[model samples]
Target: MAYQVIIIEDDPMVAAIDRQYVETDSRFQVAHVLKSGGEALGVLENCRPDLIILDFYTPSMDGMEFVDRLHAMGQYPAIIMVTSANDREIVHGLLSRGVLDYLVKPFAFARFRQAMDKFLQTQNLLSCSQESSLLDQQAIDRLIRRQERPEPGGNQMSKGLNAATLERVRSFLSASRGQALTSEEIAEQVHLSRITIRRYVNYMVETGELASSIDYHTGGRPSIRYSYTGQTAEP
Candidate 1:
């Protein structure tokens, strides 16, 4: 069965992009696209989706308030924030409130796909029997924990790099958070050669998974630093 999704974004273009990105995965479908949190609340009177692609700033009531009301009414579905807001407090608060994932604006298709893939994995585990074995419980626990820590490996593979190793490099940078890392630094952590790491880094930079910056010094050649941007590459 396809996962039902509701999108609450004020911008029509962004909403359309969100819908398009999710539709690329056959496992998901958008059931409704409302312009504001208020409209979404009204629509929920008749429909309930498996997930909600929400923006932080919406008309009537913003995304945070909408979530507050949802919790007050005891309605919780997996939520992934697709907004331009980058305040650290807001991100931390949403995570604390059990939001599934957060995607900033101008994100690549892969980032959106990453969140949907996670939701699918969680849904699969949840579809199992409630009285399942201890092993099943352990697996679910691990999956939940994986969300808090970025683990490398995605379905998307670029040339000369497999998904597994690509993710390993990604995971290393993600673990570092906003810290600026170079190809040499990442190579050491992922245990790959600099040349190989550079290729992967270049690919990620192009794909929007990572952001690169140039560092100039007094006496040495300029160095490049890469940071995980929490966004995906273009489709």
Candidate 2:
């Protein structure tokens, strides 16, 4: 089950690097490398790769516009936005447009591998369904599409935390190391609801894994803030 990949980037040099990465993985094949949205539209209808690596900045039409056009043509290749834009708005924009996930630019090889592996995990679950294999929906859903599962050797599951929640919490904590982030800030960073984040934070604090403090510096009354203690074992 080799998945074909298409790279659409304006930068030829960067596109070549992405091609190299795709080729290194046995499960993925670089199907095409195109520059602009127009060029992509030219052959995409014919190429129909399993996944598309899109760049945000491109000449002519941009990635989002091209994705819109692609969907209009009844095409839905799993999209992963690979760009230098680390802005939360950009990440939310892609998610709002139904992108599978996104990867920020200047990523290390390990991070790149993580992104690709997560896509493959989702593909694995879908392939099983296509094969007519009977699967428990909850179990499969829990196991499927885990884009950030921690290394199992850590054994942090004993605290009753699964990979999804653990990864979400970890990323939030990592991004909030220097400053205390409000519940809303944590939610936005983790792409979870503020209520849901509170629940997770409460759990971690109850387990003595996270630290929370009262903040009055931002005005509008004082509010509680949550952050990881940086002492919890990475699981």
Candidate 3:
């Protein structure tokens, strides 16, 4: 089925670009595009979308505040914050709150595609599951806690991570909560090199953090799915 999406952006140009990107493929569609969060609210009541691309800043209501209101009302939508802001804290904060993914502003169409693709893949993984997630304190903590790794030489990295490349990869596996992904897919979401991603996936499999299954009928190596045993990825 085609994924329905909404764009909540203040800039007409940016919103237009986003709409075009969402409708570029038949697998995705833009249900509605609005300039402010309040406009989004009424329109959304009548039309629901699978995902919402939110701008952090708008004239009427900002993205974060809108998200807070949505949560208060027990409404949840897989959201991707599409903002020009470079505030690392805000970026990580929203991500830690169970956002499907985060994208900095002024991004290329290719990057935008990667973000949506990864999110849909994650959604697919979520849909295939039959079990329910508990919302206990521990579960909430795991969902929001910092999971980035530190770079070598003890210096801070471009993105927040606390360990070496492989260690960070291991952390993602243990934290995935049982999601399967390809190396390229993981790399896109994590902001890492594809080669580095493959190395980490391989390491995880060797260490038993991930198990590989073959696509014998399809060809090539079997796709590996990792079951995160530590905490629930859901918040």
Candidate 4:
């Protein structure tokens, strides 16, 4: 079954890009593209969407207010917030109010695809037969986790490092162009540990999406600096 998706974003370009992204997946359909919370609220009253891709800032009303109104109307659908806002307090509040996932602005297609796939996985789990075992319940819990999952080909799942997150780190660096970033710096931006980021950076360098150079110091240990190669990072 194709999942219905509603996108509420004000910027025409961003909305268009989002719609294009949704079109790439056959399992999802773009049901509506409203520019404001008020417009979405009206249409969503009768439209039963399985998911909503929301923007934080909008005319007429904002995403937060729209969510509040949806709750008031008792319309509960999974929400994936796409916005430039990175305020921790706002994110905490939104998660508390039932947001399924959060994606910062300027994210690449890989990250977006990962989010959609994970949501689909959750939906599939929810539709499982009622005679579910404890193992099935555990699997469902893992699927419902907000974190990205490793690609099937990778054997490093034990590290909690996923291909999507690795691509995210690569995409972030690609956006930086020629700037050299340390593992610590990348970790800070990507919200991963220094070790995890370092592993991904090395893997990217091996795969040729990025190149690494040694930064020598007088007495300290030489540091590795990573730069984007202006190529696709897909393995």
The predictions' CA RMSDs to the true structure, in order, are 11.8, 14.0, 14.5, 12.5
What lDDT would each prediction earn against the true structure? 0.77, 0.71, 0.64, 0.77
Residue-wise C-alpha lDDT for candidate 4, range 1-235, written one tens digit per residue: 7899999999877787788667555568999999998999999878989999999999987778889999899899999999998898889888888888889997755567667766876776676656754447566567657344655455543445586887698689988988988777889988998767766765565446777664544254445577898755343
Cα miss at 42, model 4 (Å)? 0.3
Candidate 3 segments exceeding 4 Å error: 129-235
Q: Write the per-residue lDDT of candidate 3 for residues 143-170, one digit (tens) a residue.
A: 3442222223343232233347656666
The candidates, ranked best first by lDDT, are 1, 4, 2, 3
For candidate 4, what is the TM-score?
A: 0.63
TM-score attained by model 1: 0.61
Across 1-235, the per-residue lDDT of candidate 1 in tens digits comes to 8889999998876776677566545567789999999998888877778999999988898778889888776789999999998899888878888899999987765566567767877776666566854446577686767553133554445244777888888788888987988778888888898777876776676567887665545255446678898887544
Write the residue-wise lDDT of candidate 2 on 190-220 in tens digits. Answer: 7887656765665455444666665546544
Clashes of 3: 10
What total of clashing residue pairs does each candidate reach?
4, 0, 10, 0
Output the worst ten-in-a-row residue range by lDDT, candidate 1: 149-158
